[model samples]
Target: MTTQHLQNRVDPWGQLRTVASRGTRMGNRGILHNDANQVVRPWKHKRWVTCMLEFKQIKRPKPFSRGNYSELFFLDEATAFAAGHRPCGDCQKARHLDFKEKWLAANVDAQLRSAISMDDVDKVLHAERCVPGGGKTTFAATLGELPKGTMFEFAEAAFLVSAAGYLPWSFDGYGPAKRIDGATAVTVLTPASIVRAFEQGFVALVHASAGLDDPAAVASAQKNPS
Candidate 1:
């Protein structure tokens, strides 16, 4: 019998999955290990974080080692951001600093702008991404209002908005682009603050399947309404 590894892949709704994929960061989903090299818990904490794959030549810990945090993976920074995680300060110092700089600049509130710590940013993100009852937080908005790299839920499916159109998200990869009316109201899955970051020129790396950067693909998508 094959033992199932811990559910670690983060979807657009911030739920955990066991799908396989390439991820740039190894995140923490709390301690889920047991003596038998199996996950005994799904998550033990709420402070989910995204860290650089390697740090300072440190020896890698055995995957899902006992007493260690469960390893979660994201397709890219965009996916990670959508899943309500921030860069790990220790391993991802440069990225964390960049994120903090953009996060503070995006805030309109003077008090928030004055703050220099990631804790404040995390607090705001926590509020926006999680509800009081322990579910993912979501907001309503029109497709046009959201910037590129933002993910949203519509028709009970998750999609990534891009220059081409709405790319359907799947566990394996993104599907073809589907055009939508700009004025149509949709449920945005990504946090509002992170959405602002996208608008402020902080781009999130999307999967190659998105094809947003491919002019031919974008033109084809425009020609074919799907």
Candidate 2:
């Protein structure tokens, strides 16, 4: 018998779901699950973060142990960022620092101080990525203004903006590329602040499923189904 999995897989919009595949990265938003092993809340704190699946070869056979932060999964770093999660300072120190540096550099201005803490970052991100009650915060942007690695909602579906074009997102993997007009306005899934980080040279790791070239090539692969 197959063991049942919980709803821990996170999408670009930060909603959780149960999927057969456990994505590339692990994350946490405090203890979201209850003693019954069911996810009871969206988040417990503002320090939402993503980490490497395997850190220092450490393993947790039980991902949602009692009193422990619930384990969350993401398809890739881009998904995590779009979900309003930054790199974990503990498990992903280097990336955390890098993200912090670039994030501040991109966001800070004459009104803000050069030195800021992660808590401040969390506060800003929380305000930008979530609504007062419950919902992912989104904004409108034209395709050309959005940087590569940004995710956007087009035609009621989530898609990633790649160097070549926009690739449709899925629980299984990304689909064929669909090039659109650069001036087309769309709802961006990634937070406005984090999108600025991307503009400041922060690069997100996309899944290899998007490695396929142009639309024709990806379509051909999808048709062949190797």
lDDT values for all models = 0.72, 0.83
| Tens-digit lDDT string for candidate 1 (46-65) | 66688755578887676666
Off by over 4 Å in 1: 1-3, 32-46, 108-112, 212-226
Decoy 1 TM-score against native = 0.82
**TM-score leader:** 2
Q: Write the per-residue lDDT of candidate 2 for residues 66-163, one digit (tens) a residue.
A: 88899888777788888999999998798898898888889997457466889999999998888865599999999889998899999999999887
> What is the Cα-based lDDT of residue 108 in candidate 2?
91
Question: Residue 140 in candidate 2 has what lDDT?
Answer: 98
Off by over 4 Å in 2: 110-113, 212-226
Query: What TM-score would each prediction reach against the true structure?
Result: 0.82, 0.90
Angstrom error of the Cα, residue 214, model 2: value is 19
